[model samples]
Target chain A: MNFDLVAQLAISGLVIGSLYALLGVSFGLVYQTSKIFHLAGAIPFAAAGYAAVWAAKSLQLSIWLSIFIGLAAAVIIGVLILVLGYFPLIKKKATLLSLFLISLGLSVAFPNLLQIVFGVDNLPLEVYDAEGNPAVPFANPTYASGFLTITKLNIVQVVSSWLLVIAVLYTIKKTALGRSITALRTNPAMASAVGINNKVVYLVVFSVSSFLMGVAGILITLQFVANPTMGLQWTLIGFIAVFFGGITSLGGSALGGLILGLLSSLSGIWLGSQYAPIVTFAILFLTLLIRPQGLFGKEAI
Target chain B: MKTTNLILNASNINGGYGKHQVLRDVNINVGAGEIVGICGHNGAGKTTLLKSIFGIQPLTSGEVVFKDKDVTGFNTSKVTALGMSFTPSDRPLFRDLTIVENLQLGAHIVKDRSLIADRIAEVMEIFPILAERRNLLAGRLSGGQQRQLSLGMALMVQPSVMLLDEPSLGISPAVVEKTFEIIKDLAARKGMSVLLVEQNVRAMVKITDRVYVLRNGEIVLEESGDDSRKRTDWWQLF
Candidate 1:
């Protein structure tokens, strides 16, 4: 592979990896606390991207404002799931499998509902100039001592993704909320007995996770066109990242995302791009077979 | 004795886990400044009775009164808000939290931050070891220290009645003795009412003012500590 191509691919990989990490963190948070596999979490990512695009186009809102609206919508969706979808089952002490199925049903329903509203066409977010015209940057080539360089968007994605990962890590490590989350993960019954309202904690966690997922959706949309079906691919990548990292460890998930990103990128370059998914799935299957707990998972009680 | 009124009353209580009736029509009462010991075999309803009072386990059919107010069917937090605290036998301390954080959680119902701090200070005065290890993670503490922390957490709420389930379980003999001593001090000095459930009949009788022997979800024997000790034939129930 050429040096220019390698740099470009690596940067793209990092951006995708960062988005994956954010998604993994969201999935990990819910799984760690409630031990419920929230299949509906994927919906927020697709919904937010589409919502942002539609709002920006139809309402003539600023892109940033549209993003915020999308995030708010994601939070509402999260609360709906927590209250309407999960609460009743939880109140009844429903089995984990049943909760998983319910989440799956919501996951399927959310995207299909979006398709019905927005149609199945891929929606491109309009990046405009002062003249209200598409401002597609011309491809600038660099040939310096037998090497080429890519555009600035790749650089921005690389920097922003890493920054977000660091910020998330710092927040979870240093905050009171983080401590409470850790305590709940370790022993929820004890945490509740000590007066930490489990319900409140779960709600906060769900909202935060959904917000992060929504943010990831925006970032991913910036990188590629948004579609009603994009959430499933992102969700699959997120699940792999979460499992690779050790489902319970936030740090592990971030690391897993980076590793998976690098692997997928390298495989796409070396092998056929079609083999990338196969390679990723093979790695995941092997990880599961060899170490079912993932890289940083705690030993089973 | 201060002659304080009864703090907890349970009449005709029946409960069990999953169709197995562990506590059957059991009647028990604990007054302020009283330490009531509940002793029973492994399968007996001692822990079940405590669970029923704490609202952790649903009562099959019974009435639980706290401070002469009917608190039956109240959830755990509501029951806790009503001046009753439970320390489960499993030592349900928030293992990932520091000792101070765990204590803070105990006073979670207290909305005023100042009052919560004051309660923490008061609990520290009672358990100096906890105060010393305030910054350490609860799981890092020795079993004895955890037991003390659990008891301290229960005390943080300043509950009228403290329900302690097997405070001595899994602790060293030395720590077990110290735990019982603290139980005694709470009853004697603080005038705290305690319902202590334990399988260790000998240790429980040493600190409790009154003793109840539970068998097959029923209280078959009730006596003063001295009377129960002198008549040791109850040991056969186990």
Candidate 2:
């Protein structure tokens, strides 16, 4: 009931919400176009954070270089999942359930693989100094207004999230590739009939989606630390956001994530942080019951 | 027409979905500047034939020679690159996209921007209703207008061979006549070859230079459009 506490919570929610929005876009992009559940999208999401952390610690790389490598790693792994995993199944005319099962298997397997490689310890984003001692490379400055405090990184998270979402929406609206994606999503049979290569479009979708997931992972890693178990939780939250926002519209999914973030943050005022996910799922359930199409979605996808 | 002037020839085509055969040695051809019609009852492989020729449906065993090239077993994109376009019967246009966006997607393979612009302009000219609704979502258009936009999208490729499945599927009878006229005009003017499948036998027969009646998976009859119109025993063809 403290107003100052409420305002601070709201601000914190927006920051986390922005991250959720980015994740939603990442998950929604692949799901909307390919109708692949892509449960294994978690692999790329976690991979980005782990890769960035590894690059900084092991290679003594700069923050920017590590982030770039992280994004690149995410992209490569994401595309490989499609090429080596889904594409073969697709060629064999695998059902959506079958594809989801494969994705689920990979999702379960990759994190364990990461644990074996990185050990069962959380790795913070830090660069090793000349003496091989780890140190935070960048100064994430804080900016405060009124009763609320925010960081430069928080601002970056919010701005980059919106910018990337807008850029993706614009691409879907104006670019040739965007048109093809829209075509594939809306009318796939017509898309193929008009010479839109399914494989090429799927490749592009996976790359872009993976890139967004990497950014989300990197941003979260900067704030907290990278752990093998972190991917699926955030990814499930993103999936919830997409469903909450509506699966049909990407912008809707972004908005959904923001709302989810706000609600989860505000719920901390009355309930413990442990109940945030319960609140999130409750919203999803209510949304499904009240409006299955989602707040921004035109129809049920 | 002479076989030498054939622009599209699908000979010995045998194909189906899974193990169920939908096409059985279905041989069909289209001459340049000709509008050919394939009319039959539902489930008569009318759509499968067009899909087969355009490589949307995989042929079990066949050869599709387009423009003197053996395009057999080619995917839709490769076939489209070879100046062939297919427009499916149901929801041909990307319904969520604007008329202009759909046209742009129609020319998705074309790298030349100017050529795409020109094609869009030409398609708009051909279907003025689409021009008026250029900014509107294709799904918002009327059935007749949707048909026009679908045809315009197909024409965006400026294809040598266009395989249209059920042009008269959902449109009014009046629109069906207009659609046929437009098809005839396009074929005549652009020297484009059209092979359209339709269940609207009367409407299809009116515009076609040649008609092939498909029953089950085989061509039951092939006749000149003039002879097809003169016949009264259409029931026996199926």
RMSD of each: 3.7, 1.7
Worst 10 residues of 1 chain B by lDDT: B1-10
Error of 1 at A135 (Å): 6.8
Cα deviation at A64, candidate 1, in Å, is: 2.4
Residue-by-residue lDDT tens digits, candidate 1, A1-301 = 5766776667657767777777878888888888889888988788788878877777767767777888887788887889899999988889999999999998878778878898888887654556677432221232233354545555555566667667767876776677667767877666656556678889998998888778787777765778877877787788898898788688888788878888787766678778878888987998888887778766421
Which stretches in model 2 have alpha-carbon errors above 4 Å? A144-147
- The TM-score measured for candidate 2 stands at 0.96
- For model 2, the TM-score of its B chain against the native B chain is 0.97
For residue B166, model 1's alpha carbon misses the true position, in angstroms, by: 1.1
Docking class of 2: high
Q: Which candidate is the best by lDDT?
A: 2
Q: lDDT tens digits, residues A1-301, model 2?
A: 7998899989889999988999999899999899999988998889999999988987889889999999999999999999999999998899999999999999999989999999889899987767887766443577777788888888888999899999998998778998899889988999999999999999999999999999999988988899988899899999999989999999999999999999999999999889999999999999999999998987875
- lDDT of candidate 1 at residue A35, scale 0 to 100: 88
Look at candidate 1 and give me any clashing residue pairs.
Answer: none
